[model samples]
Target: MYRVLRGRVNSVGFLPDERLIPYLELAGFVSAALIQTFDLRYNLISALVERWRPETHTFHFPCGECTITLEDVALQLGLPIDGNVVTGVSLISRPATLCYELLGHSPSEGKFTGLRFSWLKANFEHLSSTANEREVMQAARSYIMHLIGGVLMPDANDSMVHLMYLPLLSNLHNTRSYSWGSAVLAMLYRELCRTTDPSTMDIGGCLILLQLWALYRMPFLASISHQSYIFPLIHR
Candidate 1:
């Protein structure tokens, strides 16, 4: 018997404040935010996972073998494929201080592990009109953090995002220099491999990209009618 994997399709409905759009663009994530709504076909995702071959990192189909590439990530999700690798210190010795510096606030000492999506929303969802430049930038960082934890690189622990990524956003202009598309692809590949195991129940990483890639490549799998082609492709 084959087990159909469940996708972790959590809601990432928060939109960035207009004030933060300029900064988000500089960080190379503004396009991704355009993909606000879509329906997840759980059965389709489960079928695809069933065909995944971990060793090859490709789906084995009767027609031919195929896989999601960096190009697919860039076009489908609008993340930067070229530039520096998306990596840094995974362990933060002083997370509180880092948060204070980049986010303008810090969790209480000894209580910091990861930032909860709820906390991000509660604090940064709305910004005052009179907010200064520093406040606007801080809110933008928090929004990006929410996107990373809730959409791009989510893991089994769905509620909180590890503080390691916060440091990367310290320089919004330089953040775009990282190959975010590559990182998203790598995480999805790892999740696909893990789901090949019979015991695995939930799938992580960007299911939106996986489903959209399949729909574009294998039109037979899609139920929606084609629309005008959009740049990011996810918006269509």
Candidate 2:
């Protein structure tokens, strides 16, 4: 959230949350420790931004018809997604194992946890086809707040009250197949742009733009966390 907000406020506007790895380049051990300890996937989001730059050559057809399937997209991005938009995958939660890693112990090599995107797909289907960027961002924002809430407690007045849990570390294997968090986010962005120009629907870029609206850690959040955050629940 902090990264996304900063990215929006910066001169380049919003771009892949400003590359967290760059700041940690000197601390390889810390980076390695973080990966082992938390299995965080934000790094992958940054990498996707780099690879899918507008000027960069991509397999995605911008000027022509979008003949690509979701499976192809998942494979191209190295995301561990499977099945189609109809059926969903399963991911195993591993918060306890992640806790162990922080205590100088290795995480259990258990199965990865997941969430379903079928409902997301259904939700996407129901969202107004003419949905604007702001609407997309609002959806992303609630999902993020709900995700954090699931890790501990549901946001008391959060919009996404249906979310019960989110995976930890190893459970967040790849975007969708791991936890379906980023996958659903990316899906929302994609669905919103379906009828629009392919060039404008740059997946990574669009996702970052949407993420800016999901800002939970802006500079002023300290002042508003207790009161302003509890806006009327948006049921998208």
Candidate 3:
């Protein structure tokens, strides 16, 4: 499966030219490790940001589709994903294993833990520089946070709560701070209904769309992460 992505135009380059490899590598690894460790498929997790791809030749993933959840991922992996979007991670919490696999380390061959942090930090700094970088960085961070909260801190109130709250808060606000806020909100609300009471639909879904009304003034929510640099390129 990993081989299928090789020499594929480096889709990430469209967002952050310099940081593409590191983020892509981490994404591919996380997707792969999650698939193997928890038996989830890459398409589900990949689908989250896949819809926001710019109309450029460099990016390869699909765009403008429904939001993919950790639950869908777990279901695809054949794991018992129940109770909310996060409850799926309790089945396999192995950061060390996931990090090792992503960095190409073998279990008997010791661990490559430091490489994981180094890669993330380097890419983080590299991605914080411009508009496009900010969007892509946030997306990547959101993905990592999903893995961390779903798998490692499944019930942890801090990160998981914040993760859920961000979409809610963003939807309520007037500024389109992030391009995918609505998409993320949709997924969060769905999970809210799935894991809790069916009646939650009234609150989660309503709150999300209501907040997203503020997005009318903000068009960059979908492509803002990488568009900062793209506009100049187009104008030139």
- For model 3, state the Cα shift of residue 129 in Å: 14
C-alpha TM-scores of all predictions: 0.90, 0.22, 0.24
Cα lDDT computed for each candidate against the true fold: 0.82, 0.28, 0.30
* Residue 117 error, candidate 2, Å: 22
Of the two candidates 1 and 3, the one with more favorable lDDT, higher being better, is 1
Candidate 3, 117-184: lDDT as tens digits:
22333344344445464355454443443333333223313222122322211211211222232333
Question: What lDDT score is found at residue 76 in candidate 3?
Answer: 34
In model 3, state the lDDT of residue 224: 40
Best by lDDT, which number? 1
lDDT of 2 by residue, 140-236 (tens): 3323322332221222222222222322222221213342334433443443333133333222222322222223213332243244222221100
Write down the worst ten-residue block by lDDT for model 1. Answer: 227-236
Candidate 1 local lDDT, 1-236, one digit each (tens): 44456766555576778898899898999887767745776666767787889999998877678999999998988899999988867678888888889999876566476898888888888898999999999998998888888888889878888787888899998999999999999999999999888788999989889888988998855753232221113211
* Candidate 3 worst ten-residue window by lDDT: 2-11
